[model samples]
Target: MKYKVFVAGSGGIGEAAALLLREWCEFETEIFLGDVSEENLAKAKNFILQNSQKTSVVETILMSKDGTNEAMKSAFESCACLLDCSPGTQAPRMARFACDFKMHYANLTEYVAETDEVIALAKDAETGFVLQTGLAPGFINVLAMSLYRKFVEQFENETIEKVGMKVGALTAHAHQPHFYGFTWSPIGVATEYVKPSRVVRDYEIRQIPALSDRETIIIGGRTYEADLTSGGAADLPDYFRHKAK
Candidate 1:
């Protein structure tokens, strides 16, 4: 059986996901790439088709900011899942659509407020809702939790001292003034910088301003600067509050 999947953005992440699903998903899938921009949707469709290695079908839809487009609604009604790769600000809207359509939902947004809204909306949903599924909050959080679990098992200890999680996606070389190149959404980067970070400090969860604590570190014999950023903690601040400091 071929599953229908809806992708809610045609930008970098969304396009990449569509391509990946087309090429790598175990089950056959039909991907519908939706974006506010027809130009982007066309480009993404071309890219996916050119690079696809499977026989999955790829389609496109024009999604409005409010997500009330009749065409988009028709597409949503057929899909079994919606992968939200749109801006973090749009997560709640996409999640609502998922709920209304009775489809499973997954999102890559690290926006805390929008994520919370989705969580509340999906709490009683029959389908599943996955959020904060990008590298920092998703992968790093899982990796840290696994390591902590292994550490506890290895030492035969029920609790630990401190747990620190950090992640950075950087270019080969960064110049002065932002020290960053635009590999992903600049707006998302700005949002992370301005939002407060949630972390477990002294065995309790606390909110601190982004970049409030800066430190110098050496990785692979290269010295670099690091600081606190928002949304990367995932649920660790709550999960490990009593177990780690």
Candidate 2:
């Protein structure tokens, strides 16, 4: 059976995800790439077609800046799942469409306010709603929890001294003055730098300013600076509150 998947946003992440779904998904998939820019939509469609399998179908829908386009709504209503790779600020709107369309909703936004709104909206939703499902908050959080569980089982200890997690999407070469290139959204990077981070310290969940505590570390013979960032903690601080530091 062919499942229709709607991807709202034709940016880098959305294009890559749509291509992956078209090529590697378990079942046959018909993907619709929606974006406010026709150029981006065309580019995304071409990229997907170049990399997709013959059995998969790729379509495009021209979305409005406000996300109120009737064509976009029709596309959403026809899909089985809505993968939102748009900006964090737009997460709530995309999630609302998902809930109303009764489609599984997943988003890659780490904006706490928008995520909270989606959580409230999806609390009673029959369809599944996944939020902040990107690199840091998504995979790293799960990896940390798994390692924590293994540590407890292996050492027969209920608590540990400290749990620290760091992730970076850096380019091969670094220049001076913020030695980072734009691998992801620059707005997202700015948000991480400015927002307050939630972390467990001294066996308690505490809020601290991002980039407050910077440390130098060497990985694979390369040195890099690391610091606290928001939206990467996931639910660890909440789960580990009063459990471990």
Candidate 3:
């Protein structure tokens, strides 16, 4: 169905998502881009307008941090879905708006506490509320489950030694002090590094401190260091507690 989408953040991810929706969506789409920064909103609007193959009605709204303004209310009430590309810290706020407006909510945040807050806010909501729909926690987790299901069907065995899921966000070049460079949100990297990780150990669900377990591994004839990080495993550790080691 043709519908309106409200993009909560106008930063890198938000802008890209808006552009993709306009360019790739088969159905006609009306997009409302909202952000606290006017410059970001302008840039995002220009990028989508210039790059999209299909013509769409794109509007930009200057949203308050708390989303209490009249413009925010009008946009929230109008859209069918709220695609939250804001920072992890703004997850619950965005989810709350979606729930109140009876709109579908989706976000790409790995912050554990914020995710939990969204869960609580959306537990009784009628509309769909999807959280952590990002690369590491979202796509990687789904891929692991798909592989596990395939393994059980092919081998006729649910028991497995281990299902290791690893993902790394790296830059082409590095600098002094910290070797990693950010192509995305730096807050996400910091939060995942400090927060506790949800993992399955000894066929039981456990919360282990992030980065506590570190090891060296070789992949594609290259050496790299890996560690436990928060939210990367998603809920696989819980769903496969006894089924996988």
> Which one is best on TM-score?
1
**lDDT of every model, 2 decimals:** 0.88, 0.87, 0.89
User: Model 1, residue 107: what's the lDDT?
Assistant: 89
Q: Deviation in angstroms for 14 in model 3?
A: 0.8
lDDT per residue (tens digit) for residues 1-245 in model 2: 89999998999889999999899877889999988899999999998888765656788999888747788778877899999999899988898888888999998887777787989999988899887788888888888889999999999987788888888777889887877787678898899889998888888888999999999999999998999988887777888888776
TM-scores of the models, in the given order? 0.95, 0.93, 0.94
What lDDT would candidate 2 get against the real structure? 0.87
Consecutive 10-residue window with the lowest summed lDDT within model 2: 50-59
Q: Quantify how close model 3 is to the true structure by its C-alpha RMSD in Å.
A: 1.5
> How big is the positional error of residue 190 in model 1, measured in Å on the Cα after superposition?
0.9
* Model 1 lDDT per residue over 10-119, tens place: 99888899999888887899999999999999999999999987867889998887648889889999999999999999888899899999999998877888888999
Root-mean-square deviation of each candidate, in angstroms? 1.5, 1.8, 1.5
**lDDT score at residue 124, model 2, on the 0-100 scale:** 84
TM-score of 3: 0.94
Candidate 3 backbone collisions, by pair = none
Give the winner by lDDT. Answer: 3
RMSD of 2: 1.8
